[model samples]
Target: METTFKNKVALVTGGASGIGRATALAFAKKGAKVAVVDWMENDEMVNLIKELGSEAIFIKCDVSKIDDVKAMVAQIIAAFGRLDYAFNNAGIEGASAATQDCSEENWDKTIGVNLKGVWLCMKYEIPEILKQGKGAIVNCASVAGMIGFAGLPAYVASKHGIVGLTKTTALECATQGIRVNVVCPGVIQTPMIDRLTGKTKEGIERFKGFEPIGRFGLPEEIANAVVWMCSDEASFVTGHVMAVDGGFTAQ
Candidate 1:
């Protein structure tokens, strides 16, 4: 068809790698001007964007900081004229520890990046989208958001809070032409998981057990779902927590 998202302007946080990176590329491929935001520098990804012959620009950002998020959004509108879509995908895979053992620092960092970061991004993103009179937003949640998981208290709590925020925000903007949604990914094949499991065969299989599909998800797989949610194809969809967990939540 007409290449969905053509001429759109999209901003993706955590865009240097994983699902964020894939979503940025996907949007660019569909003819959207992409703004890639992440704190880390990934030259290979930066070069790849240039190689794709698509309009993509990288901005180093730490979403946990509200001021940074505000400045980033301002820069996006200044450069792109208006923001049509945003993937508030910046988050941290926090320290895995039982609720009793989780330290204050770890808890603060986890909530700051995972929950507050999403809030900060939305805080600034919504106003701009409202100005445009239409926009789509997708926040990255986890299967853990839907249920409890031992030894991951902070991460679980943060993700769960994101789901709640997504629903509330969606309703508040439903009549204003803004659609907000959350994507709950299962064990995705990303560096964050690699760090958690050492990237070994046994490590990979261990995480796969959480999903009924018996495999970890690919970043591109998650990106594909995000693209659909943010496009007109899902016009009737809003405030949904779509689980990209390979049936993890189905069981």
Candidate 2:
């Protein structure tokens, strides 16, 4: 978390693609070793980080599972020796259905991955970060975390949970030299959005209208915020729920 430091290492969950991959590369570009964690393995991101002139390793992890999360952090320590920053960015957009029509299965899986997964990552990542004497954590929430959305009961609820959890954890770690915060990204152009929009022009335009900026944000934009939140530049920032939504939340 220090502004000027060396031998720093970072962990990014869901680092296989989108914002995760961007953030992982962002760290690597800054000379920090990175651990790219995702449910599915992608050696490309890892290899790309190496190309950026930094060290990187890909770990296949389902953050929703405790055992997997536990081992994921351990592997990071074993590979990089210490952890200074963490981006708990892994999440899923559950089946879109109205609250009343939402299924138990959808609810469970959504909460498990989006909500419990962040908690589980923090549960294991916090102790390791604490060992380093000082560090920072940035959890990924969403614009949905700030406001209600139709036909996404579970996703909305999980993101809201992340906002609360980040604040609580920030308070707990504030005195211990560990900063905790959450990033509520706006409508970013990523594979997730591609799926949500069905990769169609109309669907994309429909969602793009959701942004007050009159356009969708790139993954690098969100990644920039995440990287800053974990750096000394944001040392005074904790328990902050940043809405990098290009004025979407402003309106």
Candidate 3:
């Protein structure tokens, strides 16, 4: 069978590591020309995409900034001629603290990158997708978005904003053939998680018990859901918050 993304172009913010890296590779494997966008350099990921027999480019961008986001989209279109898919996955897990104890700096930083970042990306990306006449966009929210999590007020608030943003964008673009959706991932095994848990065996186990599945989710698993959302199989699906949380939210 032919690959679903053959000859298409896909952009992934935060494509340097973790779920972003996994999703970028997945898009390439399905025959999409991939643009790996992140604040960090990802020469290794670019090489890996070439090894997958697909074209790839690395664009350094801090998605929270309007100038950076606009330039990022311009570069992608300049390189690939058209954009068919996008994953706005650049984000940070801010300082863990109670709402009252959370510093304004942490709140601003978290909301800036996680919520404003997604909005900035969509602001530029949607017009491009409209140029194509049809396309898909997926923003990375979190299980924290669906439910409240103590000691993470800023992070939780930003993710909740993303869910609302996704829904509104979906409705705005639905009739125009553009689809917008958000993915809510549980505790996925990624560098960010390592930062959160210190990569210790006990720390890992503690997070594992948070989910009914008895284990942390893998980045590739979330990648699978992301690719599927951008595929024709999900053509009828938009404005949905699909959780790839391995029963975390099912509780």
Candidate 4:
């Protein structure tokens, strides 16, 4: 495997599962120390990283809260001594409903975790990366961010907000040795999608039909794009909203 990231440090929020987990492992496989932050415990993931010959720590955090994000960064620095890369991937898909029928609570919850959470992660993570003299940050967005998805106003809005936030932040930090970008994923095969689609065969097939590829994307597919964004291979790339959507957005 490529050790382009040897001796680097990477932080992945929502690292308990799905794209977050896959990206964390990718960082580990590339010889980077990893800090996996999520609301859930993921001992198995941490252990797997260790088995890959990289050090890893699982930090429990609810990305929506300011204090949690602050403490999460502090803990990462304490454990690894520096931060070089960050994947602000923690998010939620709120209850699906039309704008007129969506509940206020759902809107708050979705924006809280998906949009505010990314801002908070960057707020703390950027400083640490600056201290290290250079770093890269990839925020998790969705195809919903780039286009309208009926019945998902809150999710779509939050994702669109992330893209805007990422672009603005990238401009602010462009000369500061920190790169910020966003990945707009299509219908990925993650538990989140499963839950959103009710976990039924019909639901799964319907969701797959939305992707022109005739299948749902794997978390590893998104992980590969994320790791590349954080790697030197993308040194000249920043403020980019890359879509890994199997042509979902192209149509």
Candidate 5:
């Protein structure tokens, strides 16, 4: 897939770390100019892309806010000129709590970022990609979207929303030169997982046991799926829910 994206532009949100960071570099490696968007300030991400012999820029924006998302797309245009792919990967693993115990703030914030954030990005991004006559989008959901977890009601709901949203949007744009899909990753080894596991040997092992593959997936694995889905190699695929879950979901 190297050089498939030559002279193209790809946008990634929550790209300061983890899967987002991995996908940003993957795009660069494929010769696409990358725009790394994250609420956190991580200069090294952009610097690393430059070191990879690709063009890049960093845009800090809260994807939940319309104004911020609009500005983000605008910055991409200003920096890279056009957009061909997007990975709506900005998300949070909200506080683990039962449905009755989950706070409204937690629910709202989680939904705003994971679900609404993807919607807002697509709302603006589709127009730009339309200008080019063709593009692809991959929204990051999770296995939690397909199944329920006792302590993660909010996260589950938001991701489920992403699943439905992706399908509906894909159908709406299937003939519009834009293909949309969602990725459902299971137990990836990332800062998010670190927080979930409390960085404890026991905590990590407990979660790893959940993976039928017997190991936590690497961020790069998820990045590879997102990149491929956005590539012309996946031209016939759309409205797809891909699980890069190490067989966790199959069980």
Candidate 6:
């Protein structure tokens, strides 16, 4: 066997850490040329990609900046000749505060990175994919996108917007060779979550127990879902938000 992504090229935003990093490595292992884009630079990830003996580039980018996003995609096209897949996984966990207590800056930051970033990425990336005559895009939304979370108003709103965009984009590209979908992950054990939820052992355990699975998700688990959505294995799947939340939304 050949991997579904063999010979393909993929761009993963937030690829320096956590889920995005895991996904990039997964794609590279499957023989896809991977572009790892993130605001933070990680030498370990870069070294790991190099160790795989696959073509991988680490691009420092603030996904919320339109110019940065454009430049990043341009670099990918220059490197790979065409973009076959994109994981719009760059986003922030906004301040956990009530709507009334949330600052305007919080709102702007969350929407800029989570919503506008995704929009700008697709706006620039779609053309490249169209040029290629076939491509796939998987946006990272959240369970918060599907339901309201009281303390995280900004994050909730941005995620919901992501889901809406995912649906409409998929519909627009249904007749085209491009496929678009969203993945909604819930309570994953990521550095962001660790920082936002608290670092104390007990606090971490409490947070993990919130998920029905009795444990938070691993980055590789979410990466698996993303790779599948980007692969031809999901050729017929589009406009759907597949939840990988350990049944967090089932209830």
**Winner by lDDT:** 5
lDDT of 5 at 21: 97
- For 62-131, candidate 2 gives per-residue lDDT tens digits of 9899999999999999998899899999999999999999999999999999999999999999999999
Model 4's C-alpha root-mean-square deviation from the true structure amounts to 1.1
Clashing pairs in 5: none
Give residue 79's lDDT in candidate 3 (0 to 100): 96
What tens digits encode model 4's per-residue C-alpha lDDT throughout 184-222? 999999999989889999999999998998999999999
Q: Which candidate is the best by TM-score?
A: 5
What is the clash count for each candidate, in the order shown? 0, 0, 0, 0, 0, 0
Q: At residue 125, what lDDT does model 6 achieve? A: 90
lDDT at 162, model 6 = 98
In model 4, pairs of residues that clash are: none
Which candidate, 4 or 5, has the higher lDDT? 5
Q: Which ten residues in a row have the lowest lDDT in candidate 5?
A: 1-10
**How far does residue 192 in candidate 6 sit from its true spot (Å)?**
1.2
Could you give candidate 3's per-residue lDDT for residues 23-68 as a string of tens digits? 9999999999999999987699999999999999999999989999
For candidate 6, write residues 177-216 as lDDT tens digits. Answer: 8999999998887998888668888888877776888888
The runs of at least 3 residues in candidate 5 whose Cα sits more than 4 Å from the true structure, single-residue gaps closed, are 1-3
Tens digits of lDDT, candidate 1, 14-109:
999899999999888887888899998766665776677767777888889878888999889888888989998988878888899999999999
For all candidates in order, the CA lDDT equals 0.89, 0.92, 0.94, 0.94, 0.95, 0.90
Model 6: what TM-score?
0.96
Q: What is the lDDT of candidate 4?
A: 0.94
Q: Is candidate 4 or candidate 6 better by lDDT?
A: 4
TM-score of model 4 vs. true structure: 0.98
What does the lDDT come to for candidate 5? 0.95
